[model samples]
Target: MIVAILGAGPAGMSCANACLSFGLKPVVIERGDHLGGAQRSNFHPNLWMLGFPGETGEQMTTRLAAHYRELPVTTHYRAEVTRVAASGDGFLLTLAGAEGVRTLSVQAIVLATGTRPRATPALERFAAECPRAIIGPLSDSIRDDIRDTDVLILGGGDNALDHALFLAERGNRAVVCTRARFSARKPFIATCRARGDIELREHCARPELGHGNERVTAAWANEQRAFDWLLVMYGYLPNTDVLAAFDPAIRPALSAGGYLHVDAWQRSGVPGIYAAGDITDTPQPSVPTAMAQGLTAARAAERDLVKS
Candidate 1:
């Protein structure tokens, strides 16, 4: 059976690798130029480590990509899937690119498109003042231009702390402004605090625009404060546009707070369709969890294919 994977991130790559193990033909379509997806070019130099204190996102992506290279899967970079529709016995996919439009038929589909950042009002206002304000996808801010800027980061999650630590190490003055008390794991929080470069401001809300026209010049929590750059690390919202062509009966079963719904085996309501990674409404949307879900979905698909 021919299966089409909608992304090239960890989950999609893992799914393709699993399909190879089961002797199924897997085709991977990635919108980005690189294989790492969101992990590509998202941070300063020498800034690697998870909030739990382990390998970096780049490292994880590299390992996963290497594993995928060893598998029998076809990868198409710079390919964007414009449409997906149910076909007579499978699904029809339409892709658009510089090379022109291409269509393919597959017996099964795996939606691992993942999630993008949710933009907050604070970030919107900040961007107006300092054109350098970065939000959502971290990959856009990996230039040498951010070397000596005063950075204000919002949120208190693992990603927030990770950004703060990373920026601080790069010689940028990093300050964290959290709405609530920081509640990350003990070890991670401790590491953040130990870094003298990071200053924590607890119970502080993002500043509203003040005395600025184009970009955010100053922000006021209780008082006005100035910053050069702002980074928001609140969280991510799922990217589920490709699922719009599926039957409505399957829609509700696969949606939760804008994220896809999945069973323990990572199968969606649609028999031949599956989902994994941050796009799913899973409890923990970590890299490892996404990879595991991808493997599970691939195995379940293999079983169903054999039964047919």
Candidate 2:
């Protein structure tokens, strides 16, 4: 049975690998010019992925990408899955990419659409004016340009601290300001506390921004503080937009945080459809979960196709 995987992250790649393992044809669609999803730009090292010792998130993903290319999988890079719908005994997908607008039907679908950075009013208001002035958890987007630049990052999560460390390591003055105390891992919190270039601030009501050609001329903390860029790590929002076009009757379940509600095997409870990775409802998001979910979902879908 032909299956469509809508992503190229660990989960999506894992799904493709498993599908190939079971002699199932798989098509992978990725909207980005590159594969690997958010992991590509994450600066922190991933400790879970076996065999690749001390590999950072991006490095791990790089290896996975190379492995994926070697497998028997059809790939559509720069392709967007604009729409999705349930067909007779399968699913129909609309795409807008190198082939323009076209649709394909598949026996099963695995949504590893991953996640997008949560938008904030402060960043949105000036995003277009200063595209380089701000970035999200994918901190590398502005790392090269931000060297020796004063940058303010907002958030209290582990990724927030990760960004702070990343920026400081790159010679940028990193200031992490949060509205409340940190909710990150203990080690991350301790590291941030011990940092020199990175300064941690708490109890901030919210960042008050002043306009500049590069997004912010000043931010109000106790006084007027200016920075070249405002990096925000407010958290992530799932990219399940393709599901919106699905029939209402068969729409996949969503969690309070907007991730898909998948079973242990990664079924979306909407036969022929499944979810994995950051898009799934898990208390904490991780790379291992994404890969395992993809493997499990693909295996389960293989069984379903056989039974059919």
RMSD, model 1, all Cα superposed? 3.7
Candidate 2, clashing residue pairs? none
Residues 1-308, model 2: lDDT tens digits: 99999899988999999998887898999988888888897657786677767788878878888988899888888898777777888988888998789898999999999988886665776665665455466556555666787778888898788877877888888788888898888898898789788888887766566656654655464678778777778888899887776778778989877789988889999888888898998766788889888999889898888766
- Candidate 2 segments exceeding 4 Å error: 138-141, 213-215
The 10-residue segment of model 2 with minimum total lDDT is 132-141
lDDT of 2 at 193: 87
**What TM-score would candidate 1 get against the native?**
0.84
lDDT of each: 0.74, 0.82
RMSD of each: 3.7, 2.1
Using Cα atoms with residue i matched to residue i, what is each candidate's TM-score against the true structure?
0.84, 0.92
Which tens-of-lDDT digit does each residue in 1-308 have in candidate 1? Answer: 98898888878888888888877788998877777666655443223234435555666677667877877787888888877777887778888765579998988888888888767675666555556577753455364556766777777877788777767777887788788998666776898788877888888866774433322444564566666667777777788876665556444265647788888878887888888888899887767777788888788788877667
Error of 1 at 195 (Å): 5.2
